[model samples]
Target: MKLKIKNKGDLIRLRNIIAYKVFKNSTKINKFVGYRIPRRKCDNYLVKSLIDITQIDASLIVDEVNYYGKMTMENRFDLLGSGWVRYRCDIKDDFRGQYEYRGIPWNVDIKTGYRWAADYLDENDCIHSPEGVDIKNVWELGRMNYLVPFSLHVLSETDRELQMAALIHYRNVIEDFTKNNPVGIGVNWVLPMEASIRISNILISYDVLKQTDDKDILDTEFTILIGQLVYSHIKFIWNNLEKNIFGGKNGNHYYSDIVGLLVATGYLQNKNVFTKKVYNYAREEFFKETKEQFYSEGGHFEGSTGYFKLVAEMAVFGTAMLIRNGEVIPGFVMERLYNNKNLAVSLRKTNHSYYSFGDCDSGRFVKVVPHGRFLSNSEAESKYLNLDGYTKIYGKAEKYFLEDDSSMDSLIRYTDGLIANTKNDTPSLEAVMVYQLAGKRLNYQKKYTNGNMGAEQNDKKVQISLNLEQSVLEKYPIKKSTELIDFKTQNKLLDFTLFSKMGFCVIRSDKASLLFRFGTNERSGHGHNDTLHYEYEVDGISHQKDPGTFTYTGYPEKRNAYRSAKAHNVPYYGQEQREFQGIFGYRTADNREIVEFTKSAIAVRYRNMYFEHIRRIVIRDNKVLVEDYGKRDFDIHRKMQLRKSPAYGVIDRNIET
Candidate 1:
C-alpha cells in the first residue's frame, strides 16, 4: 500500500493506525455499536411490501423482532451457508472447526444457527470441504451471511437476539486471528471478495436496520459490541481495497467487491481522503461492470444459472439502494438491470425455477425464499411450490419487463397490489414500490404510473423512466410493445438467445434446452469446454444435466472434471478440457453452426481436425429420437435413458453398443 505523499500521507497513515488499533484492541469483550446510518422514511406501500413478505401483521413489526419467528419460508437461506455440515463419509476426522479450507468450522446446525469453534485442525494442519477434498482456501466466507437472525434484523427492528449471537460469533473469529492467524498473512483475509462481502453485508444491513423507528435497538448493549467489530471490518477492507479488487479476474466476486466499496462510500458517512479516492474508483468500476458483465440476452457471463441468479440478487439490491436515494444512475445501467430481469422471466416461463445450466452451488445473496434449497439444484417436482418472494417474480417480472397484460393479474395478486397500473384508478402495489423507493423517478419529466415502468404517463407528478439516451417510452410505447411478447422465433415462449458474433446458442423447447458454448474471442470470461454439448430437461427437470462447475477453487482433479467433457454428454474429439486464459474464463474454439432447428427439433453439424460430428434430434409424445449421422463401423446399436427397462424383445430395443 503506497502512502500517498500528496495528502502528507495523512489518509494512509490514519488507515494504518486504525488497522493496528483494531488488532490491538482484540479481546473477549468490547463495546461494538458505533456505525450509524440515516434513518429512512417509509410510506404505507413500502411498509405493506415488507409485511406481506414476512406474513407478519404490519402492526406487530413496529416493535422489536422475535428472531426468525415471523420469517417467511419461501425465501432461500443459501446466500452464505456452505460446508457447515459435511457428510460423515466425506470427513477423515470428526473435529470442530475442522473444515478443509481456511481453517473454518464444519458441522453448522441450521436449527441453532451456531457455527462450531474455529480451533479444529487436521493432522496436516489443513482444512477440507464437504467433498472430502482438500480446499485450503475456504475461509468461512459462508459466515458472512449469518442468515437466520440477520434476515429478521435486516427487515425488522426489534426482538432480534439472534443478531447478538451472530455478532459475538464473528467478533470472536475476528479477534481470534491475532493469536491464531494474523491479518494479511493468514486465511480469509487473503481473499479480497471475502472481506468485501463481509463488510458490505454489515454496512448495508446496519444501514437498513437503522432505518427503523427504534433508535433504542441501535443503542442496545449487544448492538454496541457488534458495531465496533463492523467498524474494524470496514477499516480493514478499506485499507486493502487496492490489493483485493480484481484486476482481470472479472468474475462475480469482482462485482461483489466493487459494490461493497460503493456501499462504504455511499452509506458510510465518515471517511478520510484516501477512502474517498478509492470510493471514486469503486463508482467508476461499477459503471464499467454494468455494461460488460452480463450477456446481451441478460444471462450472467459466468456460464452458470446459479451464479446468474446470484448476480441478479446483487443487481436488485444495489440498484434499489441507488434508485431509492435518487442517484442519477446512467440510463445504460438501468437497461441492463431490466434485461437481466427480463431474461429471468423468459427462463421461468419455460420452467418455473431458473433454467439451471452449468455449475451451481446454489448460493443466494438476497435470500428470496424463507425456506432454502441450497445444495439441491433447481427444484423440479414442485418448481413453483415453496417459493420465497424472490423466485415468485416469474409473473411479476414478466409484467414489469414485458408489460404483458396476461401476467398482470398474477403479478399484481402475487405482490399484494404491489403491481398493476391504473390510468385513472388508485395506485397499485407496483406503482407504490417504483414511485416511493425510486424517489420521484429517473425519467426527466414523464410520469410513470400503474402497470407501466417506462409506460406512457398522463400525470405530471410521477416521473417517467428514461435510459441514458432518452425516455424509453418514446422508443417503446407500452400500449404497442405487445409485439415484444409475441414470440418471433419458431421455439415459442421466447426461449434462447443466439450470438451471431460467436455462433453460440441457448434454446428451450417443450422437450429440452440446447446450449452450444461459444466465445467472443479466445476467452468468453465464463466459457466452457463443451462446444456442442446439449442438455435435455423434461418439464423443467433435468433428464440429462450438464455438469456445471466443479468448485470455486481448489482440488485440481475436481476442477478438471468439472471443466472437462468427463461428465458432459457431448463427445470431445481431440481435447478433454477447454483451454483457458486464466481461472474464471475459457479459450475460444471451433464454432459450430445450427444446420437446422424447429419448435420440436434441432440439427447441428460440427467439424474439426480430429473428426466430424453431426447430430439430429427430435422430440414428441413424451419420447425423444436422436440420430448421429456418420459411417458406421459395422452393426448399429444405441442406448437410451429410461425410467424402466424396455421389453426383452423388440425391434432395435435390445440393441447396445
Candidate 2:
C-alpha cells in the first residue's frame, strides 16, 4: 500500500511524532514519602502540642495556592520549641482544599510569579496541561489532580470551619476527577499520594481514635487515593531515569542536572522511596555534569560573574551538606570553590569593592557572607544569630583579610619619612637648586593650546644643581610675577624647565648635582604632564618655571622659536619639533638686571638690561655652592636684569603629613 502525499496530513503526522518523542524523552517519575508522628501520640509532642495548646483545629487548615493557582501543602511546620519534629494530620476534604478540617487558615497564597511545580490546582486537580495538548481539554477530560491538602487540625475551632469550605470545594474537584479517571499526569495528582501513604503509616493508631468522626473517613479516603497517585508518579520518574541514563537522549545535560537537584532535595527532606543504590546513581550522575561546567580559573564557564557566584555558592553548600551527611565530596568541588574565592579576593580594591572585571552582575559589591554561614541553613542561623544584622557587618577576619597588606605598610613608611623633611626650619632646596635659577614661569594655560608635542624628548637625562640662598628675588608688581637672579651662568642652563614640571628637578653646582624625579611623562608624549616644570635656587635667588608648552599636533620646525627651544629650555637645535613658543631668561647684577629674549635663533644676540631690578638678598648661615664634574663647560657671568613674573600660583609652604 502506498500513502498519498498531502500537505496538512504530513504536517500533522510530523507534529505527532515530535510530541511523542518529547514526552518519551522528558518523562520522570519519582515518589517522595514523608514521615511524621501520629496525632494522638503527639499530645505533648512539640509541633502537635502547640496545636493542642493553641486550641486550633489541625484538619481545617487550607492548602496554599501559588500565583499560578497551583496548590501547595506542607505536612509539617518548624516548631519554635527546643527540638524540631514533624506531626502528621489527615485531610477532611477529599480534594484537600485550601483549609484544614477544622476550618483554620492553614495556607497562604503566594502572589509572586516564582512557584514550585505542585502549586497549581483546585484541590487534588492538577492545573498543568500536557505538552502539545490543550489545557481546557485536559480539564474536560479530568486528567489533572489536586495538590497535597494542607492539614489545619492544629488550628483553633473558629478558624477551622471558616477555612473548611474552601478545602471542601477543592476536594470535590479532585474526587470528581478521580471517580471519572483512575490515571492522570499532573504534578498535583502525583506528589500528594506519596506524601499521604508515608504520612498514613505514622497516623495508624490516630486513625482509630478519629474513627467515630465523619471527617476521619474523608481524611482516610483522601490519604489512600493520594498514596496511589504518588506511587504512579514515582514509577514514572524511575522508569524514565532508567531508560534515559542507560541510552536515551544524546544531549540533555540540563535534564540530568535538574534530576540531580530534585533527587538531592528529596533525599534531604527524607521524602524519596529510592533505595541506596538508586540514590547513589542519581548523585553520581549529578556531580559528573557539574564538574564539567567549571573553568580553569575556577569560574563558571557561563562567563557571568553573578552566575558564577551563585553557582559556586550553591555547589559549596551542596558539598558541605553531603559531607555532613557522610557522603564523599568530589575534589573538584573544593578546588573550584577555593579558586573562585582567591580570585574574588584578588580583585578587591582597598575600599573593599571589586573592579567590575568580566561579566559582573550588579550588587556584587555587597558585603561577603561568612564562610561558616555557607555550610548549612541551621548553622548559619546559629552563628549569625540574625541573618539581616550579619549582612550589614563590614570587613573580614585578619588572617584571611584582603585589606591588610605589606604593600600598604611600605607606602605609609615612605610618605611619613618624606613628610618629616618638609617640617623643620631648614628647607631642603635640593630640587629647586638643580633645575632652574630665574625665569618667567611658563603658563600652562597658554602653552597647552598649540600642542603638547616634543615635550617627551626634552626631558633632561642628566642632573645639575645650584646654591639657592645666593640667588636674588625681585617682585614685578606690574607683571604680577616674582623673579629670581642667579649669578652663575652654566651652559645657558639646558631647558629642564618643561621636563621639570613633570616632576624632574635639576640641582646643579660648581662641583656636582643630581636631577631627581619620581615619575615620568606628564605630557601627551612621555605621560607625566606636571604643571611645575623646573626649579633652581642660588644664594637667596630661586627660579621655578611651571610646565612648558609643546605643539598639540606636529613637531615645531623653528628650533630657535621661543615656543620651540627657549620656551622649554631643551637643546634640540636640529630641524625637529619645537616644544613651545617663547623663552624667558634672567640675570642680576649689583644695580641692574638683564633679561634676554630669543624670538628664534635670529631674534636675540645680546641680553636686554632692566635697570629697575630692585631685589633683596638673604644670606643664610649655609653658604650657597654649585657642584659640576665637567661633562660640559660651566661658565658664570654677571648680567643685570629685572626679574620676570612667576608663572605658577604663589608657592604654598604647607606640606601634608
Candidate 3:
C-alpha cells in the first residue's frame, strides 16, 4: 500500500505507525503460556442469586447456544438495507467467509483475498466495494459475543448433556480461531479496536464458563488456547495503542485500547516484568483518559448517545475488575459512572428507550442479547401534523432497548447495588460476576409491576431520581409500577432540563417529549453536523427524527449526507454547519445559543460564518407550533431528516444512508 499524506493529522498518525513498527521489531517480549479462568473463583451464592434475579429461560439459552455449534448467526447488514441475514461458517475453513451484497462479497476483495498483514492495508481507503472491502463484517464475528450466550447456558442449565454440547462448541470455536488466525495477520487484526473488543468478550465468556465447575470444558487444552488468544490481543493493543499524540481529543477507539489492555493484564494468569509494565501503563492511561474524555455532567465529549454507551461500559467493567482485585477505586470514578447512569436514565423515554441523536454504531464492550431478541422493536411509519392534518409521513421509528442498553442497564444497576450493598437486577452473567466479585448481598426481589426488566432502585437512588424528576418537573418521575389513571389527559407542565456542558436540553411531559441538540458546532470523532437538531414525540409516537449514521466509510457520499445538517429535524440553511474533513473529523465551526427555555416554549439560535437562523417551538393544548426566522434573502428549508438507523450497518432502506 502506498502512503498518502493529506494533512498534519495524517502525518502525525504515520509517525506513530512508524514508531510502533520499530518497537515491535526491536523489543523481545515474554511469551504467555496460558490463563487461568477467573470464574473458577466465583462465589456460589452470587451465581445462584443472579440466576434467580435474571430469571433466564433455560430452554431458550440452550437453543441459542446450539446455533453457535452450527457456526451460523442471524444479523442485519446496512450495506444491503433492511432484513437480517443468516451467516454460516465452517470451523474447518480458514475463516475467509463473506456475505454477498448485491451479488458482491462484502468483506472480501475479489482481487486481493484478505490475508494481508496489518501493515499492508490502509483502513481509510474505500477503493470500490468490489475491489476493496468493509472490514466491520469480519470484525463482527471476531467479537465472539455469541460465546457469551453459550457460557450463560452452561451456568444456568441443569442437564449434563446440554452443558457438554455448549462446552464442545465453545472449545471448537477457540481452537478454530487460534489455529487459523495466527498472532498477527488477516483482516481481523487490521484494527486494534477490534482486538480490544474481542479480548473483553473472550475473557468474559471464559470467566463464566469456568464458573460452571465442568472439568470437561476447563481442560488443559482449552485453557492454553484461551491464554494464547488473550495474550496476543493484549500485546497487539499495547503496541498499537490508539493515542491522539498530536494533541486532539481521544475518542472511544483509544478508550477501548486502554480497556482491553487493563482487563487482559488484570485477569491473565501469568504475570511477569513485561506484563507488569503493560499493566501499569494501561492503568495510568485508563484513569487519565476516563477523567478527560467525559464531562463532569457525565456525557462523553463526542456528543453521540451511541458512543456514550460504549465508553461507559468500558469504564464500568474496568472499574469492576480493579475493585475485584483489591484495588481501591477513586471516588471520582464512581461519581462519574453514577452520573453516566443518571444521564442514561434521563434520556430514556417512558417506554424505556433512548433517541439516537448523533452517530451510533451499536458499539459495546459486550453484546448482551437476552431472550433471543436479535432485532429491536420499530414502527413501520409515524405521522406528523402539517398545514392540512396529521398526514405527513414523519419517518420510520425504532426503539433500541436490546443491544447495548441491556449491558448498560445491568452494569448501572449492579454498580449501584454493589456500592450501596443493596438489591439490583442481574440481567446478564457479567453483571452477576460484577456483583459476586464485590461480595454484594443478593436481596433482589422481582417486581414485574415495574415492567422495566424487573429493575429496582437501591438506597442510593437519590441522584438518579433527581435527574429523572428534573427532566419532567411538573410531576414525579413516571414508573411502570405507578397506576396510569388517565395520565395522558393530565395537564402537567414539564420544564426544560439542560445539561449545559454536554449541550442537550430535554422537555418531557405525560403526553409529549422533545429533545434538542444544541452546542458548539465543532466535533472531532463520531459527531454528526446536527446543530439545533431536535426530535419530538406526541402520545409516545415519534413525529420528528434525527437521521442517524448508516455507515462510516462504506460510501463516502452517504456518510457525508447522513451526518449533514439537512439529515435532521431542524431549520437547515443552504450550507452545512461544519465542513467534513474526513470520514470521522470535521473542520470549521458554528454556534447554537439557547435564547429562552420554559415550560411552555423554547427558542434557539444557530449562527455560522454566513448568516444566522432562529427557531422557536411552543406547546399549547396538545398542539405544537414551529416558527423559523432567518435573513430575508437566505432561504431556509424545514426538511424532515427522517432516515432511521437503529444500529450500525443497518438503515431504513438501501437507497438511503
Best-fitting candidate, measured by TM-score? 3
lDDT of 1 by residue, 362-395 (tens): 4444321222222222231122211223223332
* Reference-based lDDT, residue 594, model 1: 58
- Residue 131 in model 2: lDDT: 22
lDDT of 1 at 88: 18
Off by over 4 Å in 3: 1-121, 125-132, 213-215, 369-418, 421-430, 437-490, 597-602, 618-627, 633-642, 653-657
Total backbone collisions for each predicted model: 37, 126, 1
- Kindly report the root-mean-square deviation of model 1 from the true structure over all alpha carbons: 14.3
Better of 2 and 3 by TM-score: 3
lDDT of 3 at 454: 9
- After TM-score superposition, the amount by which residue 317's alpha carbon in candidate 1 deviates from its true location, in angstroms, is 3.1
From the highest lDDT down, the ranking of the candidates is: 3, 1, 2
| Top-lDDT candidate index | 3
Candidate 2 C-alpha lDDT tens digits along 252-347: 223233343332333222433343444566456547645755533344443223334534433433343344345655556544544444333333
